[model samples]
Target chain A: MSIEIQNLSYTYDPKAKFKKIALKDVSLSVEDGDFLAIVGHTGSGKSTLVTHLNGLTKVQSGKIIVDGIDLTGKFDAKKLRSKVGMVFQYPEYQLFAETVQLDVAFGPKNLGLDEEEINVRVKDAIEAVGLDFEQIKDKSPFELSGGQMRRVAIAGVIAMRPEILVLDEPTAGLDPKGKRDIMELVLSLKNTLKTVKTVIMISHNMDEVARYCNKVALLKDGELVGVYTPAQLFEDDTVEKCGLKLPTTVRLARVLKARGLIENDCLLTEEEIVAEIAKGGRHA
Target chain B: MREISLGQYYPTGSLIHKLDPRTKLLITIAYIVMIFFIDTFVGFGLVFIGLMATVLISKIPVTKILKSLKAIIFLLVFTVLMTLLFYGGDKSEVVLSWWIFTFYKQQLIDCGLIACRLFFMVLGPTMLTFTTTPVQLTDGMQSLLKPLALIKVPVHLLAIIMSITLRFIPSLSEETDKIINAQKSRCADFESGNIFKRAKAMIPILIPLLTSSIRRAEELACAMDSRCFKDAKNRTRMNKLKFGWFDPVCLILFCALFFVVLWLKFNFLPFVDLTSLGWIV
Candidate 1:
């Protein structure tokens, strides 16, 4: 399913003396099977924009069409939420059931699925996130390690079988290894869960975005600066102008290009840069 | 959903804001006492004027002070309706009759007076909280309750608990918001479920909130232990609470106003009995 946002604006505490404009006339589109990474400084509407996709936030003055459902109209918000599964920052904190199976079954149960179907979905989701269903199914989610608990939480959302998955800072506050594990789990979701057609993630770690995401949307001061593919976004100076840093590999590629070593400016991964450097040596 | 402003401290450079919080606490208590002692309109009028003057002197916006009343509006209206409906005296006369209920003249007057009393009753403490920060209020509370140490009250511990409670309100609220958003994303229906289902649905939110709160408490205890915050007896404050010249003047002014209202309630004003109004006799 594709997602389209148009002319959206949001203000928190609109009547208060310290009203904050969290979003402004922002417009963007996500095509099917696109892994879009939204990057910006804090307080730049990245979270607010993602919330609008699933109807968690009421669209006061804008239009959002998710898989042809106009979100602003009197449509079924809960149904929209099921279609656009959202995994928030520290999602593990939201787990409350007695066992991993129960927690993972929470969403499908809410959907009023039959007992056999819920069990099937729960087992599939837990295994899809790379967890052993038989071992972890009966254990309390709280008993798991931080990374395991996070995977259980993601499995809970995965059980709902959403077409579009929106995650807000999924890897925040995790150790480096834990971050990589979570990112890998998310990257595998598109292939493992066939229903997941579009993935939109809000992330601060530029390296993760550069390494994984195909498309990147840049936002600043509640407005969309521009949307470009990862290579194009890293090459543009707008990333720096918006107080964002390029990924390490992209920055190294830039240095190599400036030194007349590499001809390409779009290298996004360490392996890609290394291969490019090896190619340059053979030509020289 | 951001309208929860009870116990909020408004920062304005006014005399009330600068006065010692202990003095403000005492004044607020004294003013509430005066509100109850007031029986006549003249006495209530005096207290009302005093309250308006204090609100003005505090320099906080009148609208903000009024906004605090929003929380108690239902109670205010209920009090007025109950007092009007149930209050009775042998000398009271019926002013209006509807169905099986009768409205009495004296009851109506008493209801109006009670409503005014309730309004000023809420306004007084709200003014104190508006002008004084929670830290200063708790400090002042600890100092004033120091006298209770002779009676083995654990004054310092009470103060610590109060401060911690105040500090956690905002954090807990922010955590609740985060949890709600997370659950909402998972298609957790909080709004449309039946009453039983809705209550059951709260499990997702309440469990997380309780666990996180416990985790925060544990961390706080550890941090306090690491910092050697063993007992409050040897603790020294960076900013000690002391009464300035303005504090005494403000206290005395409020005290004098209280006495004058008491005196008027007792001696001078001719009590115009509502039964004598002839609408009902």
Candidate 2:
């Protein structure tokens, strides 16, 4: 199912002195099974937009339809939440259960699943995030390392088996290895899990987005800049103009093309650039 | 959640905001004491005038100050209703007799008087908090409790703890909101449930909130330790508190109002006999 947003606008703390216009007239669409990346500067309405997908924020003045469910109408919140699961920034801070198994079981239990189903989902989720279910299931979540704690938290959300998984800065403060590990796990979820059909990630790392995301949605100062293919977005100066740095791969490809080394300078990922260079094509 | 106006400082750079926090604290005490000492409509009228003047001079919007009344309005109504329905006294005219409950004209006046007392009791301290920053209040508290420190009280440590708690209120609230939304997205139903179910639901929110708070407190402690924060004995403040000219003027005016209210309630103002108004039978 595709999610549609139309003319969405939001102001925080409305009718007060601290009111701020967080999102302004943003319209976007996400098809099923699409790896969509939302990129923006800080305080640029990225988080506000994703929170709407799960109906966490009430639609002040707009329309958001997810899988035929219209938000702002008399709709089932539990149904909507089960469809869209959100992992907030610093998600490790959300781990609070006695054991990792209990923590992972929290979401499935909330969904009112039976004891047997909860156990199965918890084990599957922990395994899906590349953790040994037997080793960590009975252990306390707090006793784990930082990266392990974060993985356990994500496993909690995954245990619910949401159709659309939205992550806000999933790998924000992790080490380099932890960052790659999370991205790999997310990609695995798309390919392996039958329940998770679409993935939406808000990220600041341009290289990570270029490698994983199929479509890129750009936002600037509470406004939607535009939506484009990752290659198309990197091909132009739009990212830089929007106050974001270019991906390392895109930066390298530009120099190689300028020096008559490759035919395409807008390649999205590092491996694609390497492949293009290996083909030994020169600009005529 | 945003209806609060108390304990939130509004910086307006007015003369009242510039007064020493110690002076403000003392004045608030004097004002609360005077409120309890007065029991006449004339005295309450004088108080209303004083509160209005204070609100005006602070440069905070009158609407914002009045917004704080919303928090205690339910309590006010409940107490007044109880008193109005069940008042027992030596002499009281029956205003309304419904079923087993009797409403008295005497209780009506009493409720009005007590409500005003409660209202001013809250507003006076609220005004002090709205003008003075939390750190200043903490410092003033520590200074006031200095005499108790001679008896082995940890006043300085208590001051630091108070200031830190005040500093973390906004951040912790923001964190709580985040956790609530996160759990909501996980299909955690916080709104619809029996009391036990609701309390059970809070486990998901509270455990995470508590853990995160502990983590944050540890980080804060480490940061403070690295900065050589040993004790408050040698710590110097950049902005020292000084009693300005308006402080003495405010004190004298408050004392004068206290005497005038006392006279109005007891000796009876010569120009107008309060009994003629029929407030007292």
Q: List the residue pairs that clash in candidate 1.
A: none
Q: What tens-digit string does per-residue lDDT give for candidate 1 at B1-281?
A: 34455468888889989999999989888887888888777777787888889888888898988888998899989998877667766435879999988888778778888888888888889888889887888898899899999999988888888878888888899899989988877778888758998899899999999999999999999999999888777668889888899998998888899878766555444675443444322
- Give candidate 2 regions above 4 Å deviation: A17-19, A253-264, A276-284, B1-18, B39-45, B56-67, B70-116, B130-136, B142-156, B238-242, B261-281
TM-scores for every candidate against the unseen true structure = 0.85, 0.86
Encode model 1's per-residue lDDT on A6-122: one tens digit a residue. Answer: 999999888888888999999898999899999999889898899888887889888999988999988887688889999988898899999999999999988889999999999
Q: How well does model 1 score by local distance difference test? A: 0.87
> How close is each model in CA RMSD to the real structure?
4.5, 4.3
For model 2, residues A196-259, the per-residue Cα lDDT tens digits are 9999999999989999999999999999999988888988899999889999988998898888
The lDDT per prediction is: 0.87, 0.88
| TM-score attained by model 2 | 0.86
Candidate 1 interface CA RMSD, Å: 1.0
Report chain A TM-scores, every model: 0.96, 0.96
